[model samples]
Target: MFRQLSERFGRPVAMAILTLLGMWLMVMVTLPQLQMIDYSFRPNLLPAQLGGPEDVWTLSNYVTLFNNEIHRAIFFKTLWSSVLVTLLTLVVSYPLAYYLAKVATPRQAALCILLLIIPFWINEILRTYSWFIILAFRGPLNEILLALGLIDRPIRFLSGDGGVMVGMVYAYILFMVFPLYNAIESLDDNQIRAARDLGAGNVRTHWRIVIPHAKPGIATGCIMTFMLAAGSYAVPALLGSPGSRWFTQIIYNWFFEGGNWNQGAAYAFLLLVLCIGFMSLVMKFFKVGLGDIAK
Candidate 1:
C-alpha cells in the first residue's frame, strides 16, 4: 500500500501523508482508546479517594454490565435497532441513488442533490427537535389527521420506538444515498444496455449487474449509518420516551447522572467492540475489502 501511494504521489509526498496519518491515529485514535480501556478496567473512585488504596484496578465495571439484566437487554436492543435503521436507510435511499446516478439528467440530479443537502445545513439538534414537534400529540400531523377525520383523537407518536426509528432513518438516509450514488455512477452504461438487450428484465439486470458493482458502497453506507445510529445520543434522547431506553442513554446516565466514569468507559468500550464486529461481519458478507471501500 505504501509503495503504491509513493509511486502515485511521489516518495516525499507519500511519506508526508503517511506521517500525518500516523500522527492522527496515534494522537486522536489510539491514545484516547487506550485511556478509555484503562478507565474501563478500573473501579470508580470519588475525589476524596483519589490515589488511595480504594482506587484500584479491577474488572468490576464490565462485571456490572453483565450482571445487570436491564443493561444487557438495552445494549442488545440498541445494537439491533441500529441495524434495522441501517437497513431502512438502505431501502429508502437506493432508489433515490439510482435515480441520481443513472436515471436523472445532470441538471435534475444536481438539483436533487442540493435538495438533499439543504436539510443538513441546519443544526442536527434543531432537526431532531423538528421531528419531536411533528410527532407530538397535538402537533401538525395530528391536527391534519383530525381535520381529515382519519381519527377522533391525537396519536402519541413520540412515546414509542417508532418515533426514534423514523428520526434515525431520516437523519442517516443521506449517508446511504451518497455512497450508493458514487458506486452506481461508476458503472458502465454499456453493461446495463447489454443486459437489457440480452432479454434481462429490470430486476435481473440490477440483481446480476448493478448490485454486484455496488456492494462496496452498500457496505460503506451500512457501516456509516449503523455506527452513527448506534452511537447517537441526541436523537434518541429527544425523541424516545423513558420506556424506550437506548444504550447511549444508559452510558450517559452512568457517566453524568450516576457519576460513574468507570462504568461509562466500560459501556463505551463494549459499544466500540460491537461496532467493529458489525463492520467485520458486513465486510465478510459483502465480500468487499477495505481497499474497495477506499476506492
Candidate 2:
C-alpha cells in the first residue's frame, strides 16, 4: 500500500500524507479508545474521593453490566434496534441507489443527491426536533389525518418506538445510500444488459448481478449504519419517550446523570466491542475484505 501510494504521489509527499494519517489515528482514535479502556477497568470514584487508597482497578463495572437486569435488557435492546435500523436502511436504500446509479440521468441523479443533502445542512438537533412537531398530537400529521376523517383523535406517535425508528431511519438513511450508490455506479451496464437478454427478470438481474457486485458497498454501508444507530443518543433522546430507552441513553445517564464515569466507560467500551463484532459478521457474511470496503 505504501509503495503504491509512494509511486502515485512521489515518496516525499506520500510519506508526509502517511505521517499525518498515522498521527490522526493515534491521536484522534487510538488514544481516546485506550483511555476509555483504562477508565473502564478502574473503580468509580467521586470527585471528592479522588486519589484515595480505595480507588483501585476492578472488574466490578463490567460485572455490573451483566448482573443488573435493566442494563442487560437495555444492552440487548440497543443491539437489536440497531440491527433492525441497518436492515431497514438497506431495504429502503438499495432501490433508490439502483435508480440513482443506473436508471437516472446524471443531472437528475445529481439533483436527487442534492435534495437528500439539503436537510443535513441544518443542525441535527433541529432536524430531529422537527419530527416532534410532525408527530405531536396537534401537529401537521395528526391535523391532516383528522381532516381526512381517518381518526377522531390524534395518535400518540412520539410516545412509542415507531417515532424513534422513523427518526433513526431518516437520520441514517443517507449513510447507506451513498455507499450503495458508489458501488452500483461503478458496475458495467453490459453485465446487467446481458442478464436481461438471457431472460432474467428485474429481481433476478439485481439479485444475481447487481447485488453481488455491490457487496463491498453493502457491507460498508451496513457497518456504518449499524454503528451510528447503536451509538446514537440524539435521535432517540429527542424523538423517543422515556419508555423507548436506547442503550446510548443509559451510557449517557451513567456518565452525566448518574455521575458514574467508570461504569459509563465500561458501557461505552462494550458498545464499541459490539460494533466491532457486527462489522466482523458483516465482512464474513458479505465475503468482502477490509480493503474492499476501503475502496
Among all candidates shown, the one with the greatest lDDT: 1
Question: What's the residue-level lDDT of 104 in candidate 2?
Answer: 100
Candidate 1, run of 10 with poorest lDDT: 42-51
Cα lDDT of model 1 by residue, 57-86, tens digit? 898999998999999999999999999999
Which residue ranges in model 1 land beyond 4 Å of their true spot?
1-21
Judge candidate 2 against the unseen true structure and give its global Cα lDDT, from 0 to 1: 0.93
Error in Å for residue 136 of model 1: 1.3
TM-score of each: 0.91, 0.91
Q: What is the C-alpha lDDT of each candidate?
A: 0.94, 0.93
- Put down candidate 2 lDDT per residue, 1-295, tens digits, no spaces: 7899999999999999999999999999999989899889989877777778877888999999999998899899899989999999999999999999999999999999999999999888898999888998889999999999999999999886878888888999899999999999999999999999999999999999999999999999999999999999999999989888999999999999999888999999999899999999999999999999998
Report lDDT (Cα) of residue 208, candidate 1.
98
Question: What lDDT does candidate 2 reach at residue 184?
Answer: 97
Candidate 1 achieves a global lDDT of 0.94
What's the lDDT for residue 213 in model 2? 96
Backbone collisions counted per model: 0, 0
